[model samples]
Target chain A: MKFNILIFTHATATHYPMNYLASIGSYAIMVREVFKKPTKWRIMKSLILKEIDDLIFGSLGIIIFISFFIGGVVAIQTALNISNPLIPRNLIGFATRQSVILEFAPTFTSIIMAGKVGSYITSSIGTMRVTEQIDALEVMGVNSLNYLVFPKIVAMFFYPFAVAIAMYIGILGGWIAGVFGGFSSSADFVEGLQLDFIPYHVTYSFIKSVVFAFVIATVPSYHGYYMKGGALEVGKAATVSFVWTSVVIIILNYVLTQLMLG
Target chain B: MIEVKDLHKAFDGSPVLKGISTVFEKGKTNLIIGQSGSGKTVFMKCLLGLIIPDSGTICYEGQIYSQLTPEQQRDLRQEMGMVFQGSALFDSMTVEGNVMFPLEMFARQSRSEMQDRVEFVLRRVNLADAHKKYPAEISGGMQKRVAIARAIVMNPKYLFCDEPNSGLDPRTAILIDNLIQEITREYNITTVINTHDMNSVMEIGEKIVFLKDGIKEWEGTNRDIFRTDNEAVSNFVYSSELFKKVRQMYLEERD
Candidate 1:
């Protein structure tokens, strides 16, 4: 029994890293397949439009609501933490702007979308895989990857627009909270918003949004397209896709920050 | 005609199809019948180029599958149609959209022309009123008909059906079988079906191949099946007591 336990532990320890590596290799292959000679432009155009409607337009309301509330909370928290009179009153607004722009809008919002849009992509494709719809495409000689995933990648090009909206709403939310809640004066908040504003920061945020958008689109699609088994497996694939998408986004956030803005 | 030679496949070292060789004739209902684990699905998938065999050759009209370029293979696939067992209709599309899909992908017809073809195929399947209904809203039989209509809309030169009668009542199953047979005759297309339905065998099994454990156990026509003495084939085809009795009566009548 002890020997068996030792073997089991040894096997598991080796399995996880190997599995992760295999997944990364498979994901790279899937990305390559997605860029192969596509279907006719007419068909692809329709698919792209449909994907945009589903992934971008459908996600707007929740993003708006969450961004605004989080921005407000950030401002209030900043105000409460400032006990030193040496710090300027407008510093509350400055801190809120930095946190909302740099982290909340791009990184946190993507983590949320990794749950929402990622699950949808994974479930839809996983269902297709289970029901043999993907097989049907393969039998028909259609490049299933190109047909299914390319449109999603194209649709996520519009994801930055959603991030842009979140940024705007988040700053507006900070304003509403800081002024009405009496955390900071409106004049000081407006001054803080303009203080030390760097144009490169906005560019960096947009760049992060674009990269995160690619993750949200493709990672879930990989899980869905290659999923096997039945309905239960589809749900499992969705959960796994969400976890991996979020983890990748967080890791990429750090790596990109160091490379681009360190 | 489709011909497979010395086909072999293995999944993770467990060989599913050891070596399979068969010829499916053109313009007839060629049925592949076997027990559940007999590698029938794998065989059909190999023929469709959905699964690459570890070692084998599948030839369509004398052109080897592996020798063809990817573009040529795709061009060849356009000539083939398949009806899946579950009637794998796209849930997002209505019956009309499902039928029109292949045409939209391959055919360059105008909107009105596409509409006319879609209507014609739907009418052929006796689904004239089901144009607007989603697959979820329709009966199982209706969904099968819609799948058939979609498969044939492109007027393919080859038709494939995988367990075309599963999950249907006897009456509906027979209807679907007859529809496939009639379509095969009308189009003079090579049609291959994978099924274990004995009823389908006796009704439309013009050329039948029986597989057991991935090996071709027997190959003959429906008429020959009753007379064959192969133990494996006889045991499978006459497993039910009712079928066994019926076979005895059939032989007595023939004598």
Candidate 2:
């Protein structure tokens, strides 16, 4: 029994690297397939419209609500942390703007969308896989990936719009909280927002949003399109997709920030 | 006609389809009957080109499948339609949309033309009333009818149904069987069905292939099945007491 346990452990330890590599390889192939032999324009047009409604339009409510509140909290925290009189009260607006724009609006909102949009993509595709609808498409000579995943990718091209809105709302919320809470004056806050306002920071944020948007669209889809088994498996795939998509987004966030902002 | 020559498949080094050969004639309802784990699904999937056989050739109307280019193979698939066992209709689409999917993808007609074709096929399958209803809102029998409508909407030359009557009542199952047979005859399609339902076999099986342990155990018509002395075939076809009595009656009547 001891020898058997040791062998089983050793086998499992060796299997993970191969499994991870295989997953990455398969994801690359799936992405390629998604771009090949496009579906009919008329059909794909309608599909893209529907996906935009689901992935972007449908997500606006939550993104706006969270952005407003998180921005307020960041301003309050920065104001409270100022112990020395040397620090200007304008620093509240500056801190909130940088935090919301640089990380919260783009990366944090994406993590939430991973739970929201990513799970939706995974569950829908995984359910199709379970019910053999994917096989049905293949039998009908339809490119299932193009029919399913391509539209999502196209819809997410506009994801940066959502992030841009989040950035605006978050800064507004910070102004409201800082002024109303007596943490900082409105004039001081506005001046701080205008201080050292680099135009390239917006570019950096948008760039990260684009890469994260692609990760959001494709990673969950990869989890979904390749899932096996039945209804239980669909639920499991959704969970797995959320975890992996968030992980990829975070890692990409770090790498991209280091490359572009360092 | 679809001709299989020495088809073989294996999973995890364990062979499921050892060596099998048969011909499914066009304009006839060909039934593949077997107990579970007999490679019936695998065999049908192979015919549908969903599964690639490890060895052997599947020739569809004198065109060898394996020899065709990728484009050619996809074009061949356009000529084929499949009805999965669970009535694998698209959940999001209404009945009309589900039936109209293949047409939308490949048909070059106007929207009105596609709609008209969908209506005609739905009417043909006796599902004209359920146009806007989703698959989940319909009965299993209605779902099966919708599946049949979708399968034939393109006027495919070959139709493959994997257990078209798996979860329906006997009466509904009979209706589905008859519908498939009527369409097969009407279109002169090479219809291949994988089923374990004895009623389906007796009702519409123009040619029957019995498989056991990954091998073809018998091949004959329905009448030939009743008269066949092969013990495995007999044991399977006459497994129920009711079928035993039916077989006995058949023999006595013949005598």
| Model 2 TM-score, 2 decimals | 0.96
Candidate 1 wrong stretches, greater than 4 Å: A1-17
Consecutive 10-residue window with the lowest summed lDDT within model 2 chain A: A1-10
State the lDDT at B55 in candidate 2: 98
The candidate that achieves the highest DockQ relative to the unseen native structure: 2
Under CAPRI classification, how is model 1 graded?
A: acceptable
User: Mind giving the per-residue lDDT tens digits that candidate 1 earns over B116-207?
Assistant: 99999999989999999999999999999999998899998889999999999999999999999999999899999999899999999999
Residue by residue across B65-118, what tens digits does model 2's lDDT show? 999986788789999999999989999999999999999999999999999999
What does fnat come to for each candidate? Answer: 0.59, 0.72
Give per-residue CA lDDT, model 1, range A115-188, as digits (tens): 99999999999898788887777667678889999999999999989998999999899999999999999999
DockQ for all models, in order?
0.42, 0.50
> For model 1, what is the C-alpha lDDT against the true structure?
0.89
Residue range A17-100, candidate 2, lDDT tens digits: 555655675677778888877899988999999999999999999999999999999999999999999999999999999999
- Point to the candidate with the largest lDDT: 2
